[model samples]
Target: MEVMQKCCVLFKPDTESKEMSGDSLLEVQRAKRAANLRESLFQILSGLYGIMIVILGAVIPITEIFMSEEIDSTFEGFYIYLYSVSILFLVYVYAYLLRRNRLKTELLTRTLSRSLSSSRAWAKGLARPDTDTKSKFRKRMISLDVSNHHTGTFYLRLGVLGFGIGSMIHSGLNFGSFVSVSGGDCSEPVQWVKPLIHLMFTFFQLYFIFMNSKMCIHRYKKLARFGLVHMCSTNICVWFRSIVVETLHVIHHSDTRGHHGAESGHHPASDNSTHARSYPHSAVGHGISHHGSPGPEYVIHDEGMEKTLVDNMSHVHHISRKLLAASVNASGNISSASKDNCHWKNMMSQAVEEAGPYLYPCTIEYSLMCAGILYIMWTNVGKRPRRPTRSELETDSEDDGVEDEQRAQRMSVDCTSSSRGLFLGILLMVGTIISIIAFYMLVNQEEMQDSAIFLTHMSGTFIYTVTLLALLLAAARMKNLSFHNQQEANLEDILILISYTGLLVFIIFSLIASILAETSTMSTLTILSNVSMLLQATVQTIFMLAGDRMFAATEKQVRKKPGREFITFLLISNFAMWAINTFQTQTPQHNPIQVDFYGPEAWAIFTHISVPLGIYYRFHSTVCFSNIWKNAWKKRKHA
Candidate 1:
């Protein structure tokens, strides 16, 4: 077993220098675990801070109104401004660190993956019949495992606990004095409410701080064990010395130095004259060549020189390894059998030269982004989509070996059948227009003007009637067959169209009521109508971006780029509208005229709820648009 172990170690050259003993190997493992722990803590802290900042920003106006009595106007404004600015600064710092770490981690992963391929090839040529050799042959091994197993679970647990604790604590504080509350007024209740709000803030903030500090200390302890300082060193001496030298250097440097540097780089006028007088053949194969292009002989000479240098390097590497092996064998541990294995020795040496260091806390950016996208889809769409049936799976499994031929056939079939029924397309067009109109009326009009009111209802009904007629004509055209050979609408498309039509019909009715009604009750209904419109638009936009697999199958398709750009632009515009509307709601000009005992008023509630959803939707849309732009740029470059 000892002889086998020695032979195995001899064959695996990459591990020898970095990990010479069991103790050092254990120490490396400890450092890796510590790094991973720090990374995980960092992500969790970042997420928590982001969530808190967003929540605080959304509720600050309402919170201020609630605390009007205790907080003086000047201090309140400054307080809100200061906190908002601080939060924003922290978010910016986190983002910078995230980007830097992401790049570093990706570079490390790429290098490690490349080295893994080389290492596996080296392991394959060992030519040993022992169990250790067979173990290495059975599977390719990497220098490092690119997984952070407990990281996700840690984040999940922390999130659940934090939210649960926060909710419970808030409820406990509020439940005791629930009935006496009258919307941020009354002296006795106001006193407790102010303290209660402050207490809740303090509790949550302190909890976050404690958790963050604990993690930081733990990280530092682990790092100390490995004698590794933080990547951004905070050493006072280093900073002091750097500042002193930089200050002196800046003072000492003169404008003449740059002029002198440029002068030295430029050739003299005499040299230029000399060169101008020389013939092209004057320095042929010698000194400074007068010709702009190298001759065939010169090119051949350069190639020969490069080949000789490479050969010498290889020879030197081989000789050094042989000498090292001889010294190791003289210690009487390395066997004669290992000495005879020249092929394995050479392979191991090459692997050692190429092998990358172990990488811990691998890049989880792609995985996390994919998970976020999945979660958004799952939440919005609701429930897992049905899996493919056995027959469908089997049909897809059948491969006739030529994928291009199969794809062409599929494309032809899609082209032939991909047309939407005329009725459905017309219905969708009218519904989209009506929904947009209704959303505009609800958002823009506090009190409906007669001209706008008359126009809104008239426009909706007229368009719907015209769209129906257009659909009938389109259906007639489809019956002629030749005009509609391209892609027709599928059942899913028809269902989406029908749903949109139904929503538009409801919105049209709500618009009529919103115009006719005198009471404030209809304000709630108006808000609901606007919500429905936004949701419909959001769902359709998401489907348009992600629905068709074929659209994304070839990003280089010229036709697809314009469609993607249009969708991205549309989503961004809609996001902007939501953002602006949400901001407008917070201003004095847009504040609700009537505040009921239940809440800050229907309009206020709508804005507050929409703001958070809008922020999340805007972020998602921004990510989508960024991806679309990147894809378009890539396609354009290739074209």
Candidate 2:
């Protein structure tokens, strides 16, 4: 009797399963609910801390930009308080994500323990003559189960830590820079405080990296026997996590292949061992796997396993989204209320409003990334294989099975019209051309150092264009597509939509900022760019949550509508700014602004970051707008 644990579910061959006692069933239910509640708490805490960090981060940049050059006593006090808040927020966010990961690890451990116990109990029943085989089987199976512990939790947690640490380091440096200027104007104690803060940040970054690397090495060594790290990924996540987290590997030594017709919803192509172990090709996020296992002739497969996993993960994901929504509202309201309050309250509110947009892109991106991770966890973690279809079984393609490879190559497109793809392609080409022209103008500046700003923008535009083209190609191949496909409207769709919208907002600001830079001083452009970013963030959020569905009234009113008011605004803004730049001349004596908002270095940093982001935004938006244009064109053509 071969007993195996597959995808976190224990399976026994040819033995009638005994029903669990009422007490055991009740205990299991209680445990499940308890685990779910714990997950919810973790998600809520993570979201709350994330919101706090974004709010604080936004304020820092704005404050730096507006900080008075005069060495007033109150100015130092305010700066110190702002930095202190940012540091605290950063620490909280990191701590929360770390705790969340720990919980996930605990859950995975518990599941593995149950699976091992079941496998062990079955092994104990084997005859004395087969003791050697039984012992070997038990060890291999246990090791394989342990290797499955490389859940996406590690990546998610690491990302959270990186964001927090990076923010801390940035804030520390900015605070140090601000205080260093205060010198004799401020007390000697304040000067020493800056050095201490700087040292702590530097030390924390170094120690954190070392400890994380050490842990990854340890995990690699521990799981080496199972061939876990054989084909490591180059993904940023895998690169930094090193070998600790890897894709699922088939345990060939287990000698149990009876996974055919396992669950009703499981795709038949998944039964192919090669497909099961390869990178996700079904429009799912990239995950690696290994295939070395051989299976039995029995048709019985573990059922209800996928449902169990989904039920749990869905609860956690839902909780996370809810937490985020609540946090967004609370943040907005707090900022609103702070407007008429005390000086500190006004400062906090001002930061929330001004910094909200600048810092918001990070929080929004993280949320979407988290959603993607959840989907990957749902599809790959604790997921059993299905029986291969006849065609799949007969195929000679050994590279992760023909069906999966084809699906992987096909690309996932929710739109079915060729016209849509054409329009999208055209939009991308136009945006590409515009970006190139803008790049040319910026590159022609007399100062070579300013080229960094141009190069950054150009690189982003180029990458954005490429992604747009890829998306256009993906959309062109669809057949009989509908936007409201129940399956298509899942969590993945929401994440993709939010991400594209966010990118579009960034691109808009980038183009505006670039256009303005041609005519304005670095300080003026920086201040206005930040303002535009904040506005974009505010509008995009409202549109996605409230206005997106309103567009469903007429397919023509879709969220991606091209030739909309926004495009008009973009065209006018670009044209007006460039025209001003073309006709105007700047002399060193001509200081045009009543306010100098940012340092020269700030301009450089903003350009470096915004240019790449702008490119991605323009590319993504072009494709989306093309789809909208196609929709409108199709309606007009039919009419």
Candidate 3:
């Protein structure tokens, strides 16, 4: 009877274990299904929100361009609409975060209070010390889950802040230009409201990004994803708008310049035939004598010249109408465009117009930076914090040690380490400055304009050639060093490649234009410049990628790092290239070969699309090279 009872007890435990196992399996399946459902919902909602924002972006610009009656009213309404929507969304997200933080705080407080009360009740008549109770409470508090806030590195944050400041300055200038317009009421609410809202949006949006760039949302995933995607789309929309406006401005100015040149009879020798071919009647009528009497030839001249003048004048009139409309308020009060306006207001307007080229780029850069940050935030939504395994922890520790060593090395690095490269870069920079000054000064003179263009292109060719040689040498040196193979491209590399496409596009077009255009000194220089840029970009990309993957091959070579000097030179050269492109290359007047070959409108379009990207590539390359110079080398300690 005892043996039978023992057998029954063992069988009973086995049955119970099987039941528990089955229940656990069911629970796991249910959890997985819930997770999968949540993921699907999130993805569906995200797609809907993205499509809505994209449609909004497309619709707003089209409406502003085609549907608006007056320029000032249209711009004012656009700003108000954009600012309102953006501010509302920003406030929504900000409020949500605040509420979440408050709830977390309250939960912690209540739990602590309950634990303390229980402890006090249990020890009411006991001899337990208060210190021990307090210690236990503190331990419990410390053991609670604390979230990890993965804010990015300090320099990246600083760069974003700096770009934001530039954008704010641009907005501030626009506000001043708007409010200081003559014949506009200083107290008019509509006149100043748009810019005020703009300023506020810029301030708040920048603050939000700075504070929460790396925030990961695990709860309220839908709302978080919506807000982040909206902000990203908004930035992209703004960037597109800015680019379009700048392109239009360029085209307008180019048309004006072309008209002025035709009126002044200062066309380039090669372009005169093209212009004559375009306006054959004007060519035929030019032989007539200029007099007040209406002879047959004089009558013909009047007809042809009038035809040409009317065509040119109509384009100019269209541009003027737009400009004048922008200066007039909704109340029909004309601002600086009118002869009756105040001289001071006119001066301010002119200054703003002149500064637009420089300010526009800043705004473009700002929007791009914001969009990138928001994209990162969007991708991080609903992600949970992962605990590192033992092997990963050890790897992290080793990486930390390497970082510390690199920091020490960077601190010890000085001019002596790269004196030759530094001096050469400084020399090149000084020469570039001189060349730029000379080019700008001469470009305004009718006879010296060609010379100025020649000098600019030649300077570009020289810089690119030198940089290409340096990159090649650096590549060869890198081949001697061993590096770990990186199977996947990182974010920086991906961005570099994307930006590089712009440069490549510009280069290819320029090369094609040079080949098809009449052979001249300018065309030859352009071909050289474009070729050098292409090769240099290719070699530099390889060099940077290889440098990024560099690791110590042996303990003996740990203290020696090559290519720092080359990187220093390349960094400065890229900055020089950026400045050149920003100031000189974008001007349609600078590359008359392209203008003559592709026509002013087509050339302007090409430049507007590509020059900004090229400028960004150079700027970003400098940042990358600086990083490589600072952090690529680390010393290993041997036991």
Candidate 4:
């Protein structure tokens, strides 16, 4: 039997250098439980705060009316400004991500590391891995195990931010909406749907906060040390520092750097630079030059210079025995042979494998929690959208350096399929516009409003379908500008047309089932958002499946970049949609017009879809970055 033990001691200084024997995984589990409990407290606090804020917003109007003062100024001063700050802060996070990405690419091209290559193929026929001359960091990442991956940790504290905001502002907005419904006489409106939506969405935000909080605590605790009190875990600080503040992971992934500081991106000898033309193609290891140094400015490739860290296994078995005993309460100790073999090694091996990857919780888990909250809050797919920041597109993109012309050219997609889909979708869109127009016309007018309303119903439904298809067409057009395939432009337009047509038809029926409340009641402007989220998820799944199959057929030889535009649109649309619904439900003139955006029974479907979607998208981007980091190490060698 192999007693549980640590394999390494960097220095033989006895007690201080002992191998890690305690159950770190067990600690993580405990952290998760603690995070959940804290989240529950936050939820309670958030609920109370939301109610207070809502009350404040509601009462201020009545207070102003009594005090005989201009109430609008107070709202503009505090509510609008505060809300704008939070929204802008959210936008800043995204801008930071894009900036980090460009820097990451530059970094990877310069980084070099000792971990860079293998000859005669390491995995044999099982995996057609990248060539021996490729950056070593990329090699290590491909063989990475799950649990080591930094995605999906924030399941506990997902919706807290929104919950807190909603609780604080919901009542104020609701009362204001009531005032609007009552023609500003400081009287409540008779509408039941808006109040219902508010209550339901409050619960939804609570749920989101709970999930992310839990995941955060688990990940955060991973940074805590085994013995010393207040000996800060480098992991927590590094991850949070980067993600929330500096975007460290983003840089690491763009271009991998080595401990010794080596360039990780492709390098070819200056001599060979003239021999081959074009990037990716020239760097690709199909041909070798006779007189080239390792390449570009410097270096060379050699198999014997490389080494695998997992070549020995005396300590792996020991670690496995202890972890198993801790997790499962096993009676018998693990055997040495089996430890070195598959029997005991499998679980430990899996853990060991995953240890490097799941270093931090990523964005997918964060989004899933949000989606879950949405699912809990609403019966329908639509919410009043925040007035689309029509001006934001002009200013923000320039600062972020995203080209307006590029976006415009992409939007003006030339293919008939894309335009035709929009055209076909327009019939559906017109119906929606008519419905919205009819809704407003009814809001102000008093003549037989109820009777004429039903007359425009079918038109509204058709417009819902067309609007969805139009957005789908728009999203696909954005996707094509990233790639360089001639046939793909036509194929994508066709695929988008078909996909939208199918989705539009499917989602319209879903709304039919949700006919209890006129989705228009929630927010007339945001009806198109439903189409956006659903389509984004579906498209991602389709591509992921395709990528999987492609890799399977080629044995990991698939050489395509994942869809960047789709991911960008998918995330912004999803998050912005969720966050902006608050803007939709609130009217600036009133303290806030109250309505529930996330309800329990129906919208939980969105939550279920989105939480996982957000988490995966964010984490996957991180993982993709991990693959991109190719450390440059020539400086250390020269030193």
- Candidate 4, residues 366-435, lDDT tens digits: the string is 2223433222221111111122132221111112122556535533432222343334334433444454
Backbone clashes, candidate 1: 8
* TM-score against truth, every candidate: 0.29, 0.29, 0.74, 0.23
What's the C-alpha lDDT at position 253 in model 2? 8
Evaluated with TM-score, which candidate comes out highest? 3
- Number of the top lDDT candidate: 3
Ranking by TM-score: 3, 1, 2, 4
- The local lDDT score (0 to 100) that residue 622 gets in candidate 3 is 77
| TM-score of model number 3 | 0.74
Query: Whole-model lDDT, candidate 4?
Result: 0.29
TM-score of the candidate numbered 2?
0.29
The TM-score obtained by model 4 is 0.23
CA lDDT scores, all candidates in order = 0.32, 0.32, 0.62, 0.29
> Which prediction has more favorable lDDT, 3 or 4?
3
Models, CA RMSD each: 34.8, 28.3, 10.3, 33.6
- Put down candidate 3 lDDT per residue, 2-97, tens digits, no spaces: 999999998999999999999999999999999889877886787687677667665754444443333434455655666677788788766765
